[model samples]
Target: MFIKIPLHISGLWYPIITNNPLTTGSIGAGINIALYLTAKLRNTEKCGILLNNEEVLKDHSRAICGKLGVNLSVDEKSPISLGYGFGLSAACLLGLSLSSLLVKNITIEKATWPAHVAEVIYNTGYGDVIAEFYGGLEIRVKPGPPGIGVVEHIYPGRKVDLIVSVLPGREDTPSMLKRIGKETYDLARKLIDELLEKPSVEEFFVKAHVFTSKIFSYDNIDKLLSPYRSKIIGYFRKKQALVLWVENEWLDEIYSYLNKYFLSFKTWIDMYGVRFENTS
Candidate 1:
C-alpha cells in the first residue's frame, strides 16, 4: 500500500549549529520531523524519522532490532518511508548524516536507502516551509523554526538567485563537518549578528550569498565533488540558470539534455517553471 507521510517544520540547520543557542532568527538550513505511519509493517507498529533520506535506514534498523533482540524482516509488507530534501546541498548532507548516526545507536537500519541522502536541510526555519509551499525563492531570517521562540518571519519578496554545482561523487558530510570546526560556525554567527544589527534584507542577501559561496568554495569541497562540476558550471552560462523566470518554456529542452548527460546518476525531479493542477 502507498502512504503519504506529512512532516512538520520543527528545527533548521542554523539553529542546530549555532554558537549562541538563544539566537533563533532565520534558518538558512531546513530541518523537519518526518512522522511516519508504520501500519503496513507486520512486525514494527510505528516509526518516525528526523532524516533526509534512507541511506542509513538499514544500519539504523539493524541496530534497533539487535538491541531489542528481535528480528524484523523487510518484507513486501514493510512500511514505506519517504522524504524529500531540496536546496543547500551542504546542510542536507549534514542533517542526513547526523540522523544516520542517531539511528545507528538503535541497532536498526533503513530497510532501503535512497541513492542520494542529504546530511541536513540547510535553511532559515523562517521561510523553508513557506518556500516549499509557494515553490519559489525566499529571503528570510536565520534559525527560522516555527513557534519556537522570538524568531519572526519576514517575506521580502526578493528573488535570491542560486547557482548550484552538482558534482558526480558524493562528499563526506561527517568529515567535512569535523574539518569546519567551531571557528567556521562562529565566523558565520558573527556575520549573521552583524546583519541583524541593521536588518537590511537586500544586504542580507549579499552577505548570505557570500557566506554560501565561501562554504561551497572550500578547497576540499571543489576537489571532492568534481564529477558534476563541469555540468553545474555549464548551467551558469545558460540564461536559465542565472535568471529567475518560472515558466515551463524550457522544461522539455533542459530535461532532454539532462536525461542524456547525467543518465547514470542524475535526473530532474521538479522543474521550477512547471505548473501542476490540483486534481484531488
Candidate 2:
C-alpha cells in the first residue's frame, strides 16, 4: 500500500540557524501545494529506503530510517524536482517517517523530529518540514520544530491557486544558506516585523519579492512577470524558482501568458497539511 503526503514551497523565509536542530527553523511564509508523494510501505524487521526509485538518497534515506525504524519504498510518481525550491528534501523525510510510523502503529507525532533533525544536520532546509506538516499559508514567527516554533496562518478570505515555474538551473540549498549574509538576515528580521503588522496573503508576495530582489538577480524573471503582474495576485522567488498565486478566474489567462515565457504547473492551496491520505 502507498501513503500520500502534501508538498510545499516557501514563498519567503529567513533561516534561523542554531546549534540545536530543535531550535533550528526559518521565519517565513509558505503555501501547501496540492502535489504529494506516494510512498509504498510494508512491515519489516529492518528499515529500508527505496527512495529516488533506488537510484539516489540511499545514504540519506537509510540514516533517516535508522532513526525512525520502519521500511519505506518511495514511488517516483511524485515529481517534485529537487533544488528548485519545492521543499523536496523535507517532504521526502516526512513521507518516509509517516510511512514507517504507519506500519509500526506509532503516533505521527514521533515523525517530525527525525525528519527535521535530518534536514538541519544535512543543511537541506529550514521551516519547510514544520510548515509543510501544518499545511495552508503561514507566517512562521518563531524558529524550530512544530511544537517549538510559532506560526500564524493568513486566510486570503478566498481560496487561490499556486503556479510554480522552475528556472533553467538548480541552486544548491546548502550553498545558498551559507551565502546568506548577516545584513540580509537582519533585513529579513525587520521585514518579518513589517509582515506581522498587516499580514495579508497579498502583502506577503510584495514584501517577499523585496527580499528576493535583494539577494538574487531577479531582473530577468521580474520583466517577464511584469505584463502578467496586474492580471495575477502576486509572486515571489526562492532562488531560481518562481511561485505565483492567482485567483481561480485568472488561472487560464495566467497560464496562457506564462506559456510564452516559462513552463509552469498549477495547483490550488491545500489547507490541510501532511496526513494519512489513503492506503491501497
Candidate 3:
C-alpha cells in the first residue's frame, strides 16, 4: 500500500500573562488530522511517505514505530534539501516508514498509489494559534498533536509589552528544547506561578509580536545575519515586541525575510490574531 498524506499545520502556544502555570496550550484548526492518520496507516520499508511538514512525518513515524518493534535509518540524501518546519525530524520520519513497511507486508517496488485524496492544506500555528484564541502570552502546553487545554491566569494586574523582531534566520525548536532542557521550562513555569500569585486589579492588552526564526544555534544565526544583523535588531527594537526567532515562516513580510536570508522566520497570520493583509 502506498501512503501519501497531507500534512496539517496546527496552531501554536503563545505566552499570556496568566496566573495558571500551564501558560501553554494549542487550538486546533479542525482540518486534516484524520487524513494524516490514514496515510500513516499504509506504511512499509519500501513504501514510505511524501509529506510537506516534517513534524507530521515525525509524529507518524513515532506512532508507527511504537506499534512495531523496529528501527529504520533515515535517508539524508535528498536531491535538494529544504527546511522542513519548526521542531521536525526527518530521521524519525524515515524510521517510521521503514517500520511501516515491515508490518504491512508490502515492498516499495510494488506499491501503487494515486494522487493524495485529502490534499487539503490548512494553515495553522502553535504559539500564534494559542494567543489568537486565548489571547495574551502563552507557552505551547503540548507538542505532538494540536489540542487545547484549560489554562487559568491567577494574576490579573501586571502587564508586559513585547517588542518582537524578525531576525533573518531560523532557530530549531527541538534543538532549543534539548539545549534549554528543563531549565527553560522550569523558568517559564516559575514565571507563570509568579503571575498567578500577584493578580492585577485591571486588564491590559499588550501589543506584541513574537517573531520566530529558523536559525537554530546562536552561532549559525550570527553567520546568516552577518550582513544586516544590526538592521534587523533595529527593526524589532523600533517595533518593541519581544523577539522570538523560530525555524519556520508563519506570516508575511516576516516570511520574505526568511527567503531573503535563505532561512525560515516565524510570523503570525490568522493563527496569532494577525489579520492577513491583502497584497493583491
Most accurate candidate by lDDT: 2
Against the true structure, whose TM-score is highest? 2
Model 2 misplacement above 4 A: 42-54
Judge candidate 2 at residue 160 and give its lDDT: 76
**Model 3 stretches astray by more than 4 angstroms:** 1-48, 52-59, 62-177, 192-258, 264-267, 272-280
What are the lDDT scores of the predictions, listed in order?
0.30, 0.74, 0.28
Worst 10 residues of 1 by lDDT: 237-246
> TM-scores of all models?
0.38, 0.89, 0.32
| Candidates sorted by TM-score, best first | 2, 1, 3
Error of 1 at 210 (Å): 2.1
Tens digits of per-residue lDDT for model 2, 44-63:
55454545555445556777
Q: lDDT value for candidate 2?
A: 0.74
Instruction: Count backbone overlaps in model 2.
Output: 0
